[model samples]
Target: MRILAADIGGTNSRFAVFRVGPGPLEREGGLTLPSAGATDFISLLERVWAGLGAGPEDFDAAVLAVAGPVRGRTCHPPNISWGIDLERDWPGPTPCLLLNDFLAQAYACRTPAVAEARVIQPGTADPRGAMAVIGAGTGLGHCALLPLERGFTAVPSEGGHASFAFVGPEEGAYEEFLRKETGRPYAYGDLVVTGSGLSLLHRFHTGRDLTPIQVAAELRPDSPTLDWFARFYARACRNYALTVLATGGLYVSGGLAAKNPTVVDNDHFRAEFINSPAHAELLRNLPVLLNANENSGLYGAALFGQRALEHATGLEA
Candidate 1:
């Protein structure tokens, strides 16, 4: 079956066509475009189809990984100005699904996206336990895969928007700085662990302004900004791991760790992740893996589409 797969984010929109059946998903065509370049979802989709030289009628089914909560067939992404209603937008009657970006990320965990993931912790994993997923891109995303008799179920989370914990006086100062900068009355993971988060962290520490890329370009393993970022990132991961009791494993996705693996592969991150007094032993025994594939979401969407296609075929049979 032919499938249309897309990963829509605040920064970019990626679209691809894949052939999936009894074998693995085979990519046909794909394209990526900056989200801000277009005014609305349909227009952006048009660009995608135009670039790929294919239309909705060309595919058997579609799965779109949206960067926000999906209510039924519609979504209002936080980072994007426009929203999506598949029923009104899609031109064909082929089965189409809208999945939360992180949900798709969870599905991608089983794909090749993490087949060769960089090991952050060599701790033993409980094969039957739950797995946690935390990734940082335009924003921080959280999800978990709960092992089940059938297989696994993806649990979506909006935890990133919740207030972040400040450890002490130093973090308190940084929290206050973030509060003032965002004018939101609190420091949240969405702003503290993403691209803009790097910019804010750099500005707070150096008393200078620079873009996220510039700050990232200057990141050294021993750099003070890198240290603070690593600590904050690790704290977020550790909290999520404990929240889900991720003994199966913790998989890190998104651009931050992919580009700067040292962010997760470092003493600072490891120390902070295992700092929990009550759960230190459990956390130490939990494995950690980081996926450097930035396009895993696309394949994930295709995998989801294939599942839906197979389910429909089963019902018909």
Candidate 2:
């Protein structure tokens, strides 16, 4: 069976074809399209299909990992100009799955490979326990991985929008600063820990706004603001870890964290991660691993499509 999988973000869309046999599917070459390449999603799909030299009927299954909420059969694109209606113009009657982009990234965690994943927390991972997965990209995305008797199941979560808790006097001041700047109550995943969040923190500290790219160019370890934001970011991770009892591990994946290895790989992050009030001992021993694979979402989308097909056909892998 041939499976077509796509991971669409606000900035770029990546599509790949995979051939499924008895084992894991083999990935064909993928094509990356900029968000501005097409006026609409259908046009983008047409271009991708033509580039693959395959008609609509050539594939038996499809999966799209979208960066927005999937309501019924349509997705209101998050920050993107185009909206997606899967039922409107699909090529065939084949089964298609639409999932939150973070959920797809969580699904990708099932596959293991040697990559440059950073260990933000040095703790033990209980394979039979629950895990938390978070990514900071177009927006903050979060999901959980629950361990079952047979394998693992992925659970979508809205933890990104959870209320931001002030740790102490320092964080409280920062919260006030954020409130005054954005003119809104501070949320955990709002302008603090996201890609834009990091930039916002930088702006608050520097009295000027800078894009994520520009912030990266000016990042300095000795800068007090960057140091404080790093601690705050780690504190958020720690809070999530405590909430879920994520003894299985905490996996961090996203464009911001993946690109800025220096920020994520510092002692400050780990220190803040372990700085819990009552459960400090428990958090200190919890394992945290970063996803080094850039194509985790694409792989996970393909895996989701494959499993969805198996379930529909009543076949067990």
Candidate 3:
């Protein structure tokens, strides 16, 4: 079946075409465009379609994994001014589906046929246990997959917006700093573990006001931003894993993890992740993997669309 999938983020959107069969998915190609180039969601879709020289009707089904909370069929990413209404805004009659981008990443983990993902921590992978995913990109996103009779089911979450917990005196001071900057009583995990968050932390840790790009370029073993960001992310991951009881595995994806893998591959990250006082042993036993393929989101959307299409066909028959 012909399928179209789009992974839409705050800063960019990637589109891909696929043909699914009994074996595996065959990808045609993909296009990436700056999301802010358009003023509205529909216009962005139009531009993507025109650039591909195809109409929405060309696809059998479509799925859009968006970087925001999806309530029913509508989504409004906090960073973007445009809102998406799946029911009203679809450009064609193709059966369309909307999913939180991290939910798509979770689906990618359960995809039966996918490239062998990199295992950052080689703790045993339990197929029967729950799987979790945490990705730090433009923002932090978290999701889980529950094992089912056949495979797994994606459970979308807004855990990224959960209150940020200060694990120590240093983090406590950082919390006060953020409160003073935003005039808020509390901070969210997204504010401390994202691309923008790294920039903010860099400024606070080193008294250097560098842009995100500059910070990324400067990140290394000796960089204070890298050390702090890695530990902060590890702490967040440990908390979320405990909350979800993710014994299956916890996979990390997104631009930040993908770009600077060394941040997660060091002793700092491992120490912080396994720092839980009572459950340190349990944390150490759980696997931590990386979704190294940046296109995993696109592939995941295709998998979702393919499943929906097949289910619809079975119902019709």
TM-score of each: 0.96, 0.90, 0.95
Clashing pairs in 3: none
Residues 40-94 of candidate 2 have per-residue lDDT tens digits of: 8889989988888886678888888888777766787655898888778566766
| Worst lDDT 10-window in candidate 2 | 308-317
Per-candidate local distance difference test: 0.88, 0.77, 0.85
lDDT of 3 by residue, 1-317 (tens): 88889999987899999998776788998799998997999999889888889988998888889999998788998767798997788876777888899888888875742366777788987889998899888889899999989967888888888898886798788889888866767888788888888888988887888877788888879887788888989988999899989999899888888887876877789999999879999999999987777788898888888788778962122
Off by over 4 Å in 2: 113-116, 168-170, 183-185, 313-317
Task: Supply the global lDDT for candidate 1.
Answer: 0.88
Give model 1's TM-score versus the native structure.
0.96
* Candidate with the greatest TM-score versus the true structure: 1
Choose 1 or 2, whichever is better by lDDT. 1
Cand. 2 Cα-lDDT = 0.77
lDDT (tens digit, per residue) of candidate 1 on 1-64: 7888999999988888889989877888788899989898888878877898878888888888
